[model samples]
Target: MTDSNVSFLGRISLAVGTFFSILGDGEFAARVQRLRSGAPVTQAPVAAPAPTPAPQPAAPALKQASPDAALQLLGLLQRDARFIDFVEEDVAGYSDADIGAAARVVHGGCRTVLREHFTIRPVREEAEGSRVTLPEGFDATAVRLTGNVVGKAPFTGSLSHRGWRVDDVRLPKLAASHDASVIAAAEVEL
Candidate 1:
């Protein structure tokens, strides 16, 4: 995903608002970038046909985080008051026709967030996917995020694999209203 430098809260807010707009429009879906980086292999060359130069160690790879996961990360950030307020302001000043348009605009602002949050890009590409080499003692899990192209539902579905492996991270709860169908149904006795 292209780095937007937009904050996490802004992405969450935009995701929710965009969902509503798509529901209203019925012809738009959020665009997301799915990224993977390759890891470099370290090896020295062996002389065979003639005198061959030893292979030099390549720079560590930097992997791009999945855009949907990034949005989910934003959702997590929304839990904080300061972040919530920042997102609110970022979302409030927009005068677009719907959240879809607004989200596209905000998407452009997340460039820095993408870079900083992940903190590393794969220096090389591996066959399986991208590989990011962390510091000597860095320990982290991979976060797998699958984005559903269902109009504008804010990258619906599960987040797992590494990092914040949260399950069922949907936008309904985070959406502006709690009086939704599910909420209303849950209020009644089964």
Candidate 2:
């Protein structure tokens, strides 16, 4: 073969080798090698076909929370703490002092609502900024590790946040006459 033809053939051989390596199929690689070396490729003896797998039963559907129930809770928050008002307010026109004062009011109201209605507890007992070691088979839902997470646990990391969990919710029952969609009534002065 000419030098150019040999170079082209070498390129083709390298491409095929790379492709086979990526595929990681030993039988196909062996067959290709036998073909390239001008050796007669023999097929291995075929085993009898296995029986088909039985059909599996479908999983049960998950129950979803009512949208109105969520809306009622939001309405309750708006009524008790004026949470929607504070959040929806445009703070750009206000001074830092004014904003801070408003925030303090909002914080106090929200805290009162939470304390009265919900039983909240920290997910992690350890204090924030403390060093922690997560053993193997750790609960991924409760504790989320961030930054440079590699390999299987026993992962050593510092606690950045002490997450909260609502153990009990005791939201007040909404009246039949009350419309949950109406977060707050329009105000008017006589």
Candidate 3:
């Protein structure tokens, strides 16, 4: 081989060595070393073995609750508080005072319904805006941490809200004839 050809080949070999070294390919590095030293490159007769497949875990079955129960709850709220009507109403045209007046009535009715049907209490005993420490292994579902959340807790932060939790539910049983899907019945005067 010419001097220029040998030099070019050496440079290519050095480049391949560097690439294989970076990839941590020890076997490839050995082969490259042998090639650079003008040693004969021989392949073994045996073919490469096929990769083994990884074992897959069986998926757990999911439990689904009846939508009728949720519909029944919504129907009861509408009946007792007119909750659906107030929420569905457009308030863009109404003045702030008018809206506030309507909201007061809605709020009173809704509060009455909630008091009668469901027992609710705050999730955290601490007053809102009070500094509190959430110890390690805290319930993630009950308290959500916001802003620069890093490392393991006890996280110290001001309580933005004392979150509500339903301690007990006492919804009345629906009659067999009653349709839960009907949130509110339409009234017509003759």
Candidate 4:
């Protein structure tokens, strides 16, 4: 709190106390970094409200989702991947080898459907397992914090997964009369 010179022991004590503080408080960590780099230290330990953040648009609003798109997606999945069939099937008696083979086919079809209909990409550019730092005000929805997510942002950790983001969707337009509820029509062979 004071600019008065601290003794060697006192500096160590400060380091130990502030190390915990830095972990819990991003602003404190930033100030510590500034001091370490010979920048002027503010007397107040409490971080002043950042004015720029005051105008930060509120966390993106959760839009009122239409079920039509969801149903359409399901229909596409059923058509391409037989996803519904795979999920609904009673595979309890199937051997692991058989299930694996079936899964391989399903996986390929599902992948194909996703690739065709959606322009998908990883949320982060960095490779998984790479060290990354999430700056303050990072979109919470985009970068889901996992495993011991404590304290303020400016989080530094290994990238567990480069999470997917749907850049674009290209679902086919359906007729107004078409019933989206029927994901897959029952077959009636003549």
Provide backbone clash counts, one per model: 29, 0, 0, 0
**Over all chains combined, what TM-score does candidate 2 have?**
0.62
- Residue-wise C-alpha lDDT for candidate 3, range 66-156, written one tens digit per residue: 8877887777678877878877776778999998998888888878878998999999998899999988878777887754455677889
- lDDT tens digits, residues 60-116, model 1? 698986454444455444432223334456455556566556454455445444443
What order do you get sorting by TM-score, best first? 4, 3, 2, 1
Off by over 4 Å in 4: 1-62
What are the lDDT figures for the candidates, one per model? 0.40, 0.75, 0.75, 0.81
Per-residue lDDT, model 1, residue 7, is 71
Error of 2 at 53 (Å): 34
Candidate 1 Cα outliers beyond 4 Å, as residue runs: 1-97, 116-118, 122-190
TM-score (all chains, Cα) for each model: 0.20, 0.62, 0.63, 0.66
The parts of candidate 3 lying over 4 Å away from their true place are 1-63
Candidate 2 C-alpha lDDT tens digits along 25-46:
4456667777788887786436
Q: Which lDDT tens digits does candidate 4 get at residues 141-165?
A: 7886654465677889999889999
Candidate 1, 134: how far from true, in Å? 19
Choose 2 or 3, whichever is better by TM-score: 3
Residue 106 lDDT, candidate 3, scale 0-100: 81
Q: 1 or 4, which is superior by TM-score? A: 4
